[model samples]
Target: MSCSIKRTSSTSYRSGGGVCGGGSGRNSSVSCRQYASSVIGGGSYGGGACSIGYGGGMSAGSLAGGFGGGLGGGFGGGLGGGFGGGFAGGFGAGGDILLSGNEKVTMQNLNDRLAAYLDKVRRLEEENAQLEHHIREWYRKQAPSVSKDYTSYYQTIEQLQNQIISATVDNNRLLLDIDNSKMTADDFRMKYENELVIRQTVEADISGLRNLLDDLTRTRSSLESELESLKDELIALKRNHEEEMRQLQSQTGGDVSVEVNAAPGEDLTKTLNDLRNEYEQIIEKNRREVEQWYEVKIEEVNRQVTSSSQDIQTSSHQLTELRREMQNLEIELQAQLSTKNSLENSLAETESRYGCLLQQIQGQINSINSEEEWLASIRCEMESQNQEYKMLLGIKTRLEQEIAQYRALLQ
Candidate 1:
């Protein structure tokens, strides 16, 4: 019988040993094969046996050092002795002569080592199950909660923005209206000032006309006093002329006397009578002319005064109406200004309230994002643990198969 073993620094192991051929005796053949691939820290081992061969392989770290050499030396010595006996004997011999006491002892030791490895594998499996249960519990405890919906908050923000836009437009429009009203009030004020100037001018003219009328009245009174004095002088002159005529008639009562020649005696009484009549007509004509002139002047003054008074009254009425209208406009403008101020305050308050709400919503969103990130990290950790568990399970399965093959070989 001959056996061979191969090993590499990379932790790969391959073995083919215990090949034997015999004739005439009960022929027994054992073949064992092992393959392993390993990395620096961890690796996998696989082995199989046919007939009566025992094979084991291990790789990487403590597993390679602890079990690889032991199993190799034990099986090599034990199988080499057992196969050597089979090769020397004839095929017709019974199988009871195949092993010596040392071979039995080596086999017993291998069986004890296999049982210990199996127990270790069972304990490892239990630990893996516990690890899996812990992973499940962690997942249950650290899972993220469902996120809250913010669509309604977004809609409310949109509505508030629209309202703010509308309020701004209304505020601008109100400002324009106030400007227009101010311009209108200024125009009315200008008109009132112009009317006041005209009224003052009319009043001055009325005062001047009143002074002229007083002067005309005083002139008429002086003319009447002069006319009365002229009439009394005319009556006294007529009485004196009649007394002279009576004296002349008494003196010429008896003395009839003579022939008077000298241009047929001039008529002195006739001349006197003619002179009185001429003086009376002249006084009457002068009085009638003075009266007509005074009456005409009085009528003209009265007409002017009446026209001026009527104009003043009309101007006063118009000024009063303008004042009332201006007052109404001022009242309306004040009301509109008050409304504008209230709306501005309301808009400002709305903006402040919504701004705070937006800030709170943003904070909530950030918190949710942070939680999602944490959950993602946890999921990655769980996946890594699951992969490691699977690797350990594969190692356990391979170890069990090797143990089953060792038992078969022992039997």
Candidate 2:
């Protein structure tokens, strides 16, 4: 039979067990205490006290005289020769207080256990040190990566910023140019209005001149009719005077009667001739003067009308050309505005594209970081399992060595 016990106390551990065998009946008891430290990889298990006890018992019997003859020793005594007399039994008890004593044996056992534990602890410490070293190296490798890769992006953003600034400047310049054009156009329009007003005034003056020419033409026609009537009356008066002279001669018959008058009535025929000639000269002079004045006025009015017509035509042509030029300028400005808008839209699209690219890069960096953390965790777990395996193997080795030592002592 075998029995065992285990317990914990204080900051130390003790554990031992013994196997007993005997040729006769026997029993033994043992007690042991130990302090130990356990570790797995880079971690520590901190505990202190333990107890272990074991005992065994066995039965044994001796032979009778008939069976003892084969042993070459004759029955030496009467009890020795009997079947039930050669019986023997033994009882043993031993106790080991593993860490409880200042005794050498206890000290040696504790020292051995402590040495084993210390060796295991040293191995674990070395592993932890290695782990820490590796972590430090990894951090060194990854530290620079913590800063985002923004150099290329920064360049692109800077370029975009520059482009935006340039575009703004250009836009302002374009606006200024447009304002200038507009002002110039307004000035031209004002000039056109002033020219139009001048043209209307000139046309009004021409109309007044034409009315005066018409009035002069009518007065000349009235003077010609009055002159014709005066000529007819003078002719009628001469014919009447000739008729009266013929009548007086006929009444006097063929008789020659001489009558003296006061200066022969002043020569009636000569007087009539003089009156007609003088009237004709006056009419001719008046007609020539009126014709010359009418011609001069008509010529002056015609010259003015020709000049006014030419000026109006020139002004109209100038206005048409200005309008065409203004239209062309407006069209060109519209095209420029359209081009600017397109450029702005392209800039916006470029910004959006770059933003998306940056987002993707950031996400990739995050994934890489997470993967690194996962790899570190896996490495730690592997190291822990390896340490546990090493510890279990060490325990197995110690148990086997102890078994071999006991067997040798028994021999």
Candidate 3:
């Protein structure tokens, strides 16, 4: 059997969050933050391995040691007080004093492997240093010092709110005025309708009076025709009496004068005169009665026509007044309708303006949500890194302890 040993000045660490590693068991997480120091080294058969991490600020440190055979070999693996040291070894079945050629070759191979591991460690150190520098730069960039000018924004918001409130109040006042105007117009319209009905009724009555006047005119014409016929009858009677008297006088002129004793000549002429006077008096009385009756009927008809004319005049005057009033009412109603239309236009503009403002506010809220999600992802990454650091520190501690025990055994 042969023996080999390995050592390190600092601890080693493996990290696995999304990283895969040995034995299919996920690698432990690691971090660069300073809290403790760990030292570790181990050797195993068939390429078994050990790892450790040193957790401390990156301070200047060094490691130096030697190994020998015999009594000097026992003193070789001692530690100095700068950083911790580590050792790893494997033993094969062989004499203690003599090394086989194969064993020498194995040792040489191990030495070469250790040299390569050291080079890799150096490269990792440089990379870690670069990462730390980048993290510091990033911390500076993301510092919470550059605050936004939210004070100005708040003032702007308050001003907008006040304007909106004022606009709303104005809109309400306009609406109230519009309602009042509409009601006034309606009242006027109703009055106009009532007056129109009255005018129509009065015109109908006037037309009725005109028909009555036509009937009276026809009656007057009939009475005048009857009076002409009576006058013609009186003329005819006087002419017939004159002709009979002439015939009687002619017959008496040829008769002989016989001395006949008569008591007295009958006064037939005087009797005839009295009878004519009585008939003329009766005819005059009847004529006066007819004239009085005609006068009375004419006066009554005139009174009815006069009353109808007065009523018609009064209705015409009222109709004129009502027409004027209706014109005024229509004008006022048109004005009110125009005012309502203007107010409706203003209301539509106000609503459109508010809708645009609401859309802008919603867009701002969406942006804030997106920023919050990005910040949360960064926080998760930082937590994962911190956990890796702790696991690496634990491994380092165990390795230091093993090295100390081995040193004691050599003594």
Candidate 4:
């Protein structure tokens, strides 16, 4: 069987020599070096049994060495160094410097492929940052650095929450104080009303006492007038009795008359004197008692009026104090309510701010995760391609060995 290995460089290797000779008189095929290095040709093959396809037209294959200086850097260098020198010492000793037709195209293609691979390797360099860092730190750097920092936001929120709690506590306390103050004021109002009622009653009593005093004065005056009239009547009766006694004396002066009785009924003048003294004593006693009673009533009324006045004053003072206290409590309650409203608003704003920040952080985390997954997939694909290239290189090496064995058989 005869087999041929054809390459892009217009070079060919066969599994059989031209005739029965492994080293035939076939001129070498010439090529040029264009890329960093150009090596075209596999190891030579010897003749085989049954050469059915006719002898491999043994042409002189002049494979050109290239300008590659490093190890495994040229085209097909992954196989071996100088694969063409398979027991034939390679091609013509010193070939032309220009590139042959097919070899030029092949070198150009190889160089382009190599350059593309290198570019892909350079482009595949890890551009994404490491994934092991803190998420907050990464966000701080990648996102707007001037944005409000969420790291300290936690502490600020806690402080605001604490302030809200304190304000609530204070607001509750103020409400309680307001309620208590209202109750106290209500109680004071009730007491003021009761005191007012008592004052009114006392005033009515005083008015009644004044009326009684006036009536007592009128009665005393009438009593005095009646006593004066009685005295005048007694005086007139005495004068008439004295005049009758005088006339009797004059009439008895002409003749001496004597009369005798067991009892003179009573001495008229003496009885008159006794009656006058009793009436005068009774008038005096009545006048003294009425005047004393009137004076006592006036004193009692005065004392009560003074007591009511003091009570009214006390009630007024207490009422005024309660009113002032209520005003103060109302003011305090208003202040506390305002403070509570402000704190509530601040709390709401803080909550909204932090909520937005949290959402942004979550979104960033998701994006980072996706990017890492993409990088992982790319790495996996690169590894797969590398493995495939290694496998192909192995296959090419095996094919070259088979050709060399064929050449050995021909020799």
Candidate 5:
């Protein structure tokens, strides 16, 4: 006889009984067999099977079974093996008692054992549930809390970046200003050099004018000496004419008469006076001309010399001012250069410090990312473990139900 039971879900049970010849041909034997199957969570479990044989008033039995389903198949197989081994040992020990012809006692013993197994399954299920609870608690406790706020760090970085940018701009501007100052200084230097050359030329011209003035002064002195000598010669000639006229008068005063056929000689005194007057007039006129020429030349030379002196003085003053101004510009430029150097140094130091800070921040960010990844992996592992636990729990439930059914059948 065979009987089969089917559930509305994917579970089934089958039991069969038959009479057969024993290994000893003179004896007859009875056999009973049961098979159960179940499905849970899209996986099927091949439930435990029990078989018994009776022959020549001696009973022998064997229990062999396995659970077949899991998330990946192996976990249920291992549990099934352990449970099957335990059931096999129990059945092997009870097999000898069946020969005493107490079927009810054997059935009672099997039912009690099944109850024990049920209790064990209950305890295991409870433990599994507790473990799941603990796992959830662990996840709750160990999971990372709200991530640390990096808004402040971001703001600080932004401010630092802005500062660096502004500093860079200012540094560039300062460098440009320094360059302009250098160019200006070079231009001023060139102008100063040109002005110096012009001053030298003016000084050289002044020297030449001074030489020419000296020559004119010497010529004026020579001309004055010549005029004085001419006057002395005129005075000497007048004295000689007077002496000759006196001798003539003395000769005439001695009462000597001379009969001469020539016209009366021209008057010596009149002729000599006329000659002196004409010579005096010419000398006076020449002296006035010479004096006027000397005056004109002296005035021209003096004016030129004075103008040249003024120009020299003005050029010297301008050169002095330019030198002073150049000195000031040089001083200012040096100060600006020094300022630029200091700013550059400060900028370099700031950049280095900020660079190190950024590196540290990046390292911190990397570490945080690594930690997050690790946490995610842990979470995934936990989830997998929880799923496995759930599968095992389902197996345990099905196993408990099978055990209950086996108990009902035995009773």
Candidate 6:
């Protein structure tokens, strides 16, 4: 028997029994073509491993450990090309040229057995190719997905955004309201201050008027004292006049008449009586004039006091009214302040409540994001596990088929 190279249209294989990278064909790049069905791995070249694995179809699919679908497509190339072109000397006496005549029978039996193994290998290879094709199609068609549709979540996000916008607008409105309230409070405070100032001014005027009234009273008292002094002086003058008259009368009652020279003494007692009469008339006129002047001054002072008292009473009433108004204003201002404070407190509470709500919403959003990430990771892990299961299933099925084929071939 001898070895020969023949080309086949449906398949090409390398013939050898050496592993990859352990032979003289270390850099050999071989290719195999299986043009039987879907043309997968057809006319494909592989590096290193193909040199010893593919051997003109002599090396079975197991030459590259196991047929791993298209992932091991290069094994076919190694099987068809590795040994036929590069494993002649490395395979020792396994070459056809080294067989003796007696060894032909043994070789024939081995060849038959190799043929059975090769048949099993071919079946496994075809299945592997089919599985590879199915897997490729699945990979090409199957969409890698992390999660389901999140349209509802998007709508929820939009709703949250709308809520946020509305909240912002409300906050601004509340701020405006607060500003208005503050301005109103300020205006009222200013009015109260101005009114207070006016009240103080009115109080000062009232105090001044009271002082004037005191001065007027003092003037009236001084005038009354002067009138009393004038009356006392008049009484003293009259007493003295009476005493002189009595003395003069006593002296004339015992005196004898005597004529002095020169016009008969001109009647001295008569002249004295005329002088006393004139003096009494003048004193009575002075008394009348003083009494009239005093009465006039008293009447004028009374009139002034009455007018001043009326004015003081009017001012006092006005001051009382102003005080009442001030009190009312103060009350109203206090009420307004209380209202403002309540409004501010309500606003603060509202802000705190909204802040908590917003924080909760943010937490929910973060949780949603974290959950999404966790789900994505789980999805990826599941997908990876599924791929591994499929790969292992394909390998297991192929190995079982190969084992069954080998058993049958042995039997």
Candidate with maximal TM-score: 5
Colliding pairs, model 5: none
Summarize candidate 2's per-residue lDDT along 1-411 as a digit string, tens digits.
122333222232122221112121111122223223332222222221221121111121222343322211111100000111121112112222122223334335534653554465457557766876877687678655565566785786678677767767877777777777778778877887887787788778768866866776676677667667766776776677677767865776787878887474577557767876887787678768877877787787778778877876787787678778768877876877787678668767866886687678668768868876887786787577566546545543443444344333223
Flag the better candidate by TM-score, 2 or 6. 2
Candidate 4 C-alpha lDDT tens digits along 1-411: 012433322223332121112221211121212222223232221221111111132223333444221111111111111112122212322323333465456435534543443343334322111222343365456554454455675676577568667766766776676677667667767766776676677667667766765765576567557657756765676677677667756775966667786665666557756866776677678767866876786677668667767766776676677677667766766776676678668767766776786677667767767866875675575566555444434433443453455344223
Runs of candidate 3 exceeding 4 Å displacement: 1-197, 235-297, 383-411
Candidate 1 regions exceeding 4 Å error are 1-145, 222-273, 362-411
Give the Cα error of residue 85 in candidate 2, in Å: 62
lDDT of 3 by residue, 1-411 (tens): 011233333322222111111110111121112112111112111221222222111111111221223111001111111112133332222111223364345445534544443454455556655765776687678744564455665676678678778767876776776677667667766766776676676667657755665666666566556656655655565555556556756766776866778778766556656766676676677678877877887787788778767876777777677677767767775776676677667767766776676567657757666765765676575555444333334434544464455445334
Q: Give the TM-score of candidate 3.
A: 0.57
Candidates in order, TM-scores: namely 0.53, 0.48, 0.57, 0.41, 0.60, 0.47
- Identify the leading candidate in terms of lDDT: 5
In order, what lDDT does every prediction score?
A: 0.58, 0.51, 0.48, 0.48, 0.61, 0.49
Error of 1 at 357 (Å): 3.6
User: Residue 9 deviation, candidate 1, in Å?
Assistant: 20
The superposed Cα distance between candidate 4 and the true structure at residue 355, in angstroms, equals 2.7
Clash number for each model? 6, 13, 9, 12, 0, 27
Better of 2 and 4 by lDDT: 2
- Model 3 accuracy (lDDT, Cα): 0.48
Error of 4 at 339 (Å): 2.1
When superposed on Cα atoms, how far off is each prediction in RMSD?
14.4, 17.9, 11.4, 15.9, 13.2, 13.2
Q: Give the clashing pairs for model 3.
A: 1-92, 1-93, 1-94, 2-92, 12-52, 29-388, 30-388, 30-389, 31-389
Global fold similarity of model 4 (TM-score)? 0.41
